[model samples]
Target: MDIKFESKEAERQYLKERLAAGFRIFAKYGFDEGPAGHISLRDPINPDAFWVVNPFGLHFALIKASDLILVDESGKVLEGGANRHLNLAAFMIHSAIHTARPDVNCAAHAHSLYGRTFCTLGKSLDITTQDSCAFYNDHVLYENFRGVVLDEEEGIAITQALGDKKAALLQNHGLLTTGGTVEETVFWFLSLDRCCHSQLLADAAAAGTGGATKKIGDKEAMDTWKVVGSRKGGHFAGRALFDLIEVETKGDYKN
Candidate 1:
């Protein structure tokens, strides 16, 4: 179950700690490719106006709650990072996502190894397993790569492609996942990469067998999705991941 905060201050602190913990968890999974990945959370007090992100070029493994910076939609640093530089791509992409989807409060994107490899296929994940069913009809493919995402136009285009989906595969790029909470977003991203890894392995084995991969029927996938794909189901799974990370890191992610 989700914890309830007595005040906005307490809620803000929780968000920061979870956001930083997310980075640490990603680092443990070898998801950090220099500064190529970013995960952000909308500030509890300023949900539409401001969000928290890591300083540009900082290693995700070394991220701490004190290292997060608050930025507005215009990319202005509001607090906590006067000396640190904001990742402009974060501003362009997250700002657009936060604006486009009021329900999404946290977003995670990374150039994870398997995610990029699977993105080359330019298709959604095949739901042949119970875990993959969580994203059965809840993901999309962003076919337009358009080089690096530096401009506002590119960010908006990506968000438009995302629509109401929980995850997206950026062709020739990587994976992007969004959720109402940091835990859910991180869980989806991690799970997405694992699914991609499984698919890649299956494809390789199938190539040798001269057979094609079998897909689960849509009706069954949809039925399983209702149980595992809902926000509540995601939160239930994400809570376990957050707990494991906290134990592994000795709770040092908290400031």
Candidate 2:
């Protein structure tokens, strides 16, 4: 499972492939809500800029490595043709995080059904299951919800709320996750969305039973997180998903 690159070009190609795989995988899991979701990977050669899918009418499932567009921190398209345009919200949210956190090479956000539903509750996930334990103390809940985030100031506020956390559940919005690699970031996004779904189900069942749900203690939850919440763990999960999607899609995303 070691990733050894002989050259920068090799690394860039790997990043691009993984990025495209991420989009396709997201689409597979119903993460694409129209053109609302975005995943951005920082360029290996240029840290100030990132590669993202172009804002065309293409669905995420149809996105390929060639469909990606390179954009600078100022939201200017640097590689894609004249027809390509960057999503303003995507640029605002992703650029703010990339600029504020150099260690974050990738950031992902989406209006996933479960994630969006959980955001409306205005509460962080409780440690109800081992999967939910991954975010026991590692996630935050952003309380601000001022409509669609079209302004840089709102983006900066979201960035501030996400400080030092692996995932943030934006109130009335959706989920955002960051990582040192695109693989890790994608895995976190998937994991957090599932956690939201699990929590909602648990809460509903508890209410039906007229009983309270039990949670893992902080010490135990933290220990569990050490195993499942690590970047290496996330990368492994991402690899598994990528392999599954590759077979299902016949590797079309690599085109």
Candidate 3:
């Protein structure tokens, strides 16, 4: 278990494979609303100014390791087939975050059903459920939704709004989650969207005059977060999902 990678090439292979797997995972969960979402990974060989992203307009379910396009901080496509092009929002927002936060190597953003609904509230998630504890005091709300994030300035604003959090709820936009690894980022995106769905249902149930929701105490929530929200926890949570997806696709995503 202590073995991380045999070499830099091995590390690169794993990261790219997981990056592709994250896309398929998102697609299976209904996170792909056309070309509205993206997952980026810091090129293991070039962690500073380069990253890998899926080609624009490609369906999440069909992406593979070889299909990812490498781009520089300035958004120029450096690799991927001749058909490769950049996703401007993916490049703008992700490049800013990758630059600002060297600690984060992976970021996943999507316009999932609940994320769209919950972000409209313009507030961070409330630690009312055990599962929501993972994000207790650990995520931010970027309430400044100035249309689509298609420019570097907008990306910078969103990054500033994110500050040092691992995830963000972009108001009127959607949810964005980042982590040190692909597994962690994908897991947070999955957990966050589900949490948003839970909140929506809970809100409907408590909409009456006297139906109030119970929230977890600060100490309790923080304690639970230590177990469920850690980087290692998220990675472990992804193992089952990844294993299943690989089997379902017959290891096609690893290509």
- Our model 1 lands, by Cα RMSD against the true structure, at 1.3
Stretches off by above 4 angstroms in model 2 are none
Among residues 3 or more apart in sequence or in different chains, the pairs in candidate 2 whose N, CA or C atoms overlap within 3 Å are none
- lDDT per residue for candidate 3 within 1-255, as digits (tens), equals 144898988987777888888899998999999988999988878776555556678899998998888888878787764567778888899999999999888988999999999999988898899999999988999888888888889999988888888899999999999998888888899999999999988888888655978899999999999999888898888778888898898889888
**What clash count does candidate 1 reach?**
0
Candidate 1 per-residue C-alpha lDDT over 1-255 given as tens digits, one digit per residue, 9 for 90 to 100: 358999998998888999998898889898998778899898989876555556677787777888898887888788885456878777788899998999998999999999999999988888878889989989999999888789999999999999999999999999999998888899999999999999999989999999988889999999999998888778778888889989988888786
Report how far residue 54 has shifted in candidate 1, in Å.
2.8
Candidates ranked by lDDT: 2, 1, 3
After TM-score superposition, what is the CA distance of residue 175 in candidate 1 from its true location, in Å? 0.2
lDDT by residue (tens digit), candidate 2, 1-255: 378999987887788888999999899999998889899999988889999887565699988888888889888888853458778888899999999998899999999999999999999988889988778778899998998889999999999999988899999999999998878898899999998998899899999999979989889999999999887888887788888988998988887
Question: How does each model score on TM-score?
Answer: 0.96, 0.96, 0.95
Error of 2 at 98 (Å): 0.6
**Full-model lDDT, candidate 1:** 0.87
